[model samples]
Target: MIELPPTILQIILNFSIGLIVTVSLNIEVGFLNLPQFGRLLAVLSGAIVAAAVPGRILAASMGLPWDANYAYHLYNFGIVAKINNMLSENPGLSIGILVFTLVIVALIGGLIGYLSAYPALRLKEAYLGITLLAFGELLMNVAWNYDPLVGGTMGVWVVDPFRFVGAGGARFTFAALFIFFIAIAIYIYAELLARSPFGRTLKAVRDAEVAASVYGKDIVKIRTQTLIVGGSIAAIAGALWAFFTGSMKAATYTRLTWTFWPWAFMMLGGIGNNLGVLFGVFLYTVSRTAIILYKGTLSAVIPIDPEWLEYIMIGLVLVAVVLFRPQGIIPERPTLTLPEHKIEMISKKFNREEK
Candidate 1:
């Protein structure tokens, strides 16, 4: 077996997280044609939940402080350290905390989605996008100011559910592998959802809302459902990110990283195509990682700041794709529900009848 380098492992981890979030965005913006400019809301929800909930639960169980003060940096660090110690010794408990956190994140994320549906019904296109974006920013600000929520500006340490795995490279590899596994599962789910009847309905609604309405499709219901599904999935990505990083800060979940980047990834990968999104995410993640790794070298050659190079490169790529390859590197293909032979036979019969 070949040993993977740390850089490669980091790429895998980043790719996995990006894939999960971008696929969730695709389900909404690509398939449903919803302008999801506030993808960060659900992601922040997940990260905040993952950061705030599980450790508190463990603390409470152990007769430690689990109240608002638990999130304070002074208490949070110690509490999380104790929790990590417990988690390291009990693999089963660690797994349970992981599952429990994800479940909570999904529920809260879905609720947020459902709540957004009211505004979604009223706002159209750009207005809706702006509303969603504002909502995410609002949440971020609240979390930042509210000391109880992930320690506000202080941040909080996340309970490491993967603590059972040995420390150093071994632990990082395990976490990366677990995240990759989840990414694959989400991809399969996205693909299946895309092929299902509901998926067809989403595309129909997206392409022609009036025609879909004429066909008796309830546009309101579909939009709500899509938001809930997408929100839940995005929340899972956020939770996984928190777990992988072993820390969480409300300020860390920014629009650029959680919302816009995913949008760029989805656009780069053929919109409405899960496989394309996967490829797009992997390509972008690796490229971004390489740029960061070689920032000093690039800075020596170019006058621009090293921090901005990645953004400039991605912006150029996005512009190039938009101007030249609007359909993306892998264009979206028609989903066929029937066998090729059957479709061909039906087509022939219809032609003969018309003749």
Candidate 2:
């Protein structure tokens, strides 16, 4: 059997993660006109919930005490190990846990979205963005200091479904496949929504809120719906992150990692174009992964620190993209709502009189 290079496997994993988050971020900033700078809030909800819930659920099932303290937290880790052993013996339990975790992640994510709309959505974009950013950081701080939330600063280990797989490469390969398929499913949904009437309303709202409101569209309703959907999708990334790393840390969901990079992916890909997200995420994730993987080798060839070199390169690439192709690699295309036949007939009618 041929094995994938670690770097290539890592790139695929990062791509899967970037795909979902970038696509969802597009829905809010591009489609909904909500510049959600704190978009990491939904993602944090997923990782935090994923950390606290499953461990507690499995613990309760095993009659282990679930409490707010370091001792119980250690006991919980033991329970997770015991559960992992049981899952190895019983595959059914593992499958159930996997499905249950994802569904709950979506629900909690949607709730975060619903709540976010209240405070920030009504404000102007500049203020709204700041509000959302603050909220995200505030929750992350709470999670970091609050032990019951996610074992506090110590973090919590999640029982990955792949634990039974045993082989490290096999586990990563399986996760990559899982993430790829899930990303595909999300892509299809985004494409369909981008072409639908509801999507048109969002575009209208994004273009001009006052104009859309004049046309009887409820601005609040549209924004709220967009947040709920986008948040739910983005949350999946956090759950997958937990599964991928086999643990959750509040620091892991920091604004820089979860929020900024996704915004970069969305902007570089074309703000309003879902298809552009695929290209953007691939380029960023692969290039970023390659840079990290070769940091040691590259440092030997250059006088600068590896970290500074990476930032310089990334900054240069971003500046070049902004200067050369401000609309991104694939600029946002006009939405087509007309039927194919109708469009063709209209074109023929226009040409017939001239001919």
Candidate 3:
């Protein structure tokens, strides 16, 4: 039996994947200044890729026929792959097929993000939110009805990516490593963007697009660029999650809950600052997991609805954040400092441009 600590650790690891999804969204909303809502699209894309790749591998190993809907579904969803292929002349080709699936999904998702920016750039607040919400609903509907996409309501079995390491290695170890590396990369990227010149432009666009335009900035182009980058990052996070969980289901990708939850995380943590997003994830994860576990224990003795309690807790936290600390716990601060060489170079460039 797995010990309590290890079990909790595993849960933390799994939750971290969710965190990546939230962080990716925060970059768009908080940093890039887009009122977007498309977390499901990215997560689904990654999950499907992760599922398909490893599923084919396991099915071939087990001697089960490929093209078996069950096997295909499992592989595509990132569930455990356990079947054989009848159509293929070579069974070994499954591995290659899996890689292809991931690439295709990522590209498709990136395209959607790029295209959406046209409309996203024009709308503000409520209108933009509505448009994105509609897009998310449309995607979810497609996932649900399209059997080929995710296996319908039954969902598909997804082959675990770590399984590629073989049965001998502990699965949890691989999961931890994947999460750690990806999380670190995201952190680095977030900080880099937060401190970069482009990042400053995003803030200007965020605060006042009209003013920014008067300053010779193209609001549409900057926002479009922000959307593209944020969308791409989200896709990468989804792909990583797919590898971690080994499955993608339509139910997993909805906007009302999954998408909005990240917004809450950003607002609670401190919007406009990456560090606040990180802090929010840490706080939310702990409260959520720990409370659920405690509630489970308490329910056996007294009687409490777990889901309702969580909802109530989340709502209260959200209200508190909005009422008191809208800027977020950490809040955005001024940290503008240019090095001597860069300052001189900028001064020379400005003088030359003027001349």
lDDT of 3 by residue, 1-355 (tens): 2223555665667556656666678778887667776666665656655554445555556654445464344444333422322212333454455455556656656776777787786787789878877777787687677676557665666544445433333555655665766676777887788789888888887788789899999877877777766666666666666555555676777675567787888888888888888888788878777777788685676576877778777888899999998999889886475767998999999999999
State the TM-score for model 3.
0.80
Please report the candidate that would top TM-score against the real structure.
1
Alpha carbon lDDT of residue 338, candidate 3? Answer: 77
**Candidate closer to the true structure by TM-score (higher is better), 2 or 3:** 2
lDDT (tens digit, per residue) of candidate 1 on 1-355: 2336899898999999999999999999989989999999999999989999998989999988999989989988898999899899999999999998999999998998998898999999999999999999999999999998789999999999988977777778888999999999999999999999999999999999999999999999999999999999999999999999999888889999999999888888888888889989989998888888998898899999877877887798889888988778898888888779999999999999999
* Clashing pairs counted in every model: 0, 0, 21
TM-score: the better of candidates 1 and 2: 1
Report the Cα RMSD per candidate.
2.5, 2.9, 5.5
Total clashes in model 2, counting residue pairs 3 or more apart in sequence or in different chains: 0
lDDT score for candidate 1 against the true structure: 0.91
The whole-model lDDT of each prediction reads: 0.91, 0.83, 0.67
